[model samples]
Target: MRMVFRWYGEGNDTVTLRQIKQIPGVEGIVWALHDVPAGEEWPMDKIAAYKELADTYGLHLEVVESVNVHEDIKLGLPTRERYIDNYKKTIEKLASVGVKVVCYNFMPVFDWVRTDMHKELADGSTALFLEKAKIEAMDPRELVRAIAGNPDFTMPGWEPERLARLSELFDAYREVTEDDLRDNLRYFLEQIIPTAERCGIRMAIHPDDPPYSVFGLPRVVKHAADLRAILGFADSTANGITLCSGSLGVRQGNDIPAMAREFAGRIPFAHLRNVRVYENGDFIETSHRAEDGTVDMCGIVQALHETGFGGYARPDHGRHIWEEQCRPGYGLYDRALGIMYLWGIWDSLGRGKQTKREAFSV
Candidate 1:
């Protein structure tokens, strides 16, 4: 596994490239042009600038967290064709700069939902938390205000421009169902996957944040069966999925390690993080250690190793520890710690396999 770190451009992120460079085993940054609006083609100059900056730090800019799919595309609006064309152009441009994987999602209205950005854990370190009951009871607009109100950093999915039309976006999706969303995604894949293949870039779709419909919005990429259907949509190496452990782990049913082993060849990107799930359906992000959360971190890494996964992986959504006061989930200390934990698991697995091979040979 090739480990990468997610850095939100120069000024946008509190964690600097210099700091990221200090993290052992991290060879690249998972990035995107955050200022670029959804559906618009990314500027080549800006893309080149990102590459240049990462070059100075000896980091590769191979994996892009997202070239966010526009709501028009997800809703199957007439204007989607224009956006799809723009997406194709973006892919070609990213390919020119040596990007191997482009991670995007098809979740409508919201990309990821959390009730609290800094829900305090028992250990005093805070992390992103989702209270299922709260989400069900609260108005989405109120939740939007809570998320977007933070002036310090822009949340990935809760962009101010997008949430400004929250009511309208909600109204637009009222008539759309899960099947309709799937068809729309299929159309999108049919249009773009070929371009991705030609560019030698795999288009990986991130699973829904909680692997469930939020605020009555239809979510197609949630479970293993959903993943199977999506891979069937375009039957190509370019068509892939980002196996996010924390996102799918909230639901006890998702066998994350099995999913990793099953979708081994198709997954070009992974977001490995842990989350503690409660009996009350609430969940909180935790350290990458398996004991700290419900997700089988070791098993997930073991499966990836067994599959000989050479794809890009990152420690996703770390806790806000040491009073870092950084992005809700994208803090430095915990993520770096998570990376070490992941490395420990991955290296041990490798050593174990080597020992077994030597014993068998003897």
Candidate 2:
């Protein structure tokens, strides 16, 4: 597994590239042009500039977290063709700078949903938490105020410009269903996978956060069958999925390790993090250690190793540790710690395989 770190950019993030360079085993940055609006082509000069900056820190610019799919595309509006064309252009531009995987999601309105950004844990370190009851009871506009209200950092999915039309977007998605969303995604993959294949870049779709319907919005990429159906949309390796542990782990049904082994060849990116689920259906992000959360971190890594996964993975989210006043889940301290834990599991698995091979040889 090739480990990478997600860096927002120069001024937009509190964590610096210098700090990211100090993290052992991290070889690249999972990045994107955050300032670029959805459905627009990314500026070529800005893409080159990002590559240049990462080069200064000895980090490869190979994986992009998202080139966000526009709501028009997800909604299957007539304007979607224009956005899809622009997405193809962005893929070619990213390919020019050596990007190997582009991670995007088809979740409508909100990309991911959480009730509390800093829900305090029993250990006093805070992490991103989702309260099911709260989510079901609260208005989405209230969520917008709670999440996007932060002036310090822009949340990935809750962009101010987009959520500004929350009511309208919600109305637009009201008529759309799960099957409709799947068809729209199929159309999108059909349009863009050819370009991605030509550019030697895999297009990875991130699973819906929480892997369930939220605020009555339809979620299509939520389970193993959903993943299988998505891969069937395009027969090329360029059509892929980002296996996010924390997102799918909240639901009790998803067997993450088995999914990893099953989707071995198709997954080009992974977001490996842990979340502790409660009897009440809420969850909180935890350290990457298996004991700390419900997700089988070690088992997932072992499966990846067994499958010989040569893809990019990142320590998805971290707790607010050491009183680090940073972005809700993008803090540096805990993420670095999470990286070490993941490495510990991966290296031990590697050593075990080597020992077994040596014993057989002897």
Candidate 3:
């Protein structure tokens, strides 16, 4: 398992690439051009600039978190073809800089939703919380306000540009169903997978945040079967899943470790964060450690090791600790701590060198 850190970008993030490089065992940063809107051709010069930045600290530039899919593409709109052309261009640009994996998601409207950004935990350290009652009863606009409350830090999924027209987006998607979303995703994969394979890039789609539908939105990437259906869309090594534990772990029924071993061959990127699931189907993102949340992070790592998942894995969202004020979930202190926790598991179980490509490939 190659450890990675998710850095927003220079100036946009409180944590710097320099600080990230100092973290032990972190081989790269999961990054993207946050300023760029989805489906636009990422300038080669801009891609080169970040690649150069990572090279300065001996970090690899290949493991970027997301290149978001436009709602048009997700809806199978006529304009989607234009956006797809642009996406193909962006993939080629990333290839020019040696990016191996690009993690993107197909969730409509809000990428991920939380009832509260800083739900107070018993330990005093706050975490990104989602209560069952709150999610089922509370308004999405309220959640939106809380997530974007910090004007300084732009939430990656909840972008101001796309979400500002919430009402319209909701109205448009109101008619769309889960099956519609799945069909559109299949359409997207058919077009993009070929381009991705040609560029030597793997497209790892992140599971829906919380691994469920929210605000009445249709979500297709929710469970193991969903992932299995998604991978079977293109039937290529370039099409895969990001396999985030915290997102899928919100539902108690998900067997994260088993899914890792089952999909090991296709999982090129992994988001290793844990969340404590309440009995009522709600959850809160906690530190990477086992005790902090319900997700069996150590067992997940053991499965990764057992399956020889020699790919990029990074600590996902973490709680805010030490009174440190930054992005709601992307704080530095706890995430760095999360990295070491992942390291502890990997060091004990991550025996032998990184596995070669052919080992897990079918």
lDDT tens digits, residue span 144-227, model 3: 787877778888888888878878888889899999999999999999999999999999999988677777889998899999
Q: Output the worst ten-in-a-row residue range by lDDT, candidate 3.
A: 353-362
Candidate 1 lDDT tens digits, 159-257: 778888988999999999999999999999999999999999999999999888888889888899999999999999999999999999998799999
Off by over 4 Å in 2: 352-362
Which parts of model 3 have CA positions greater than 4 angstroms off? 350-362
The residue-level lDDT of candidate 2 at 298 comes to: 89
lDDT of 2 by residue, 1-362 (tens): 88999999999999999999888889899998888999999999999999999999889999998999999999999999999999999999999999999999999999999999999998899999999999999999999999999999989988778998999999999999999999999999999999999999999999999899999999998999999999999999999999999998998899999999999999999999999999999999998889999999989998999999989999999999999999899999999999999988888877735432221211
| Candidate 2 overall lDDT versus native | 0.94
Ten contiguous residues with the weakest lDDT in model 1: 353-362
Residue 117 of candidate 2: its Cα lDDT? 97
Q: What is the C-alpha lDDT of each candidate?
A: 0.93, 0.94, 0.87
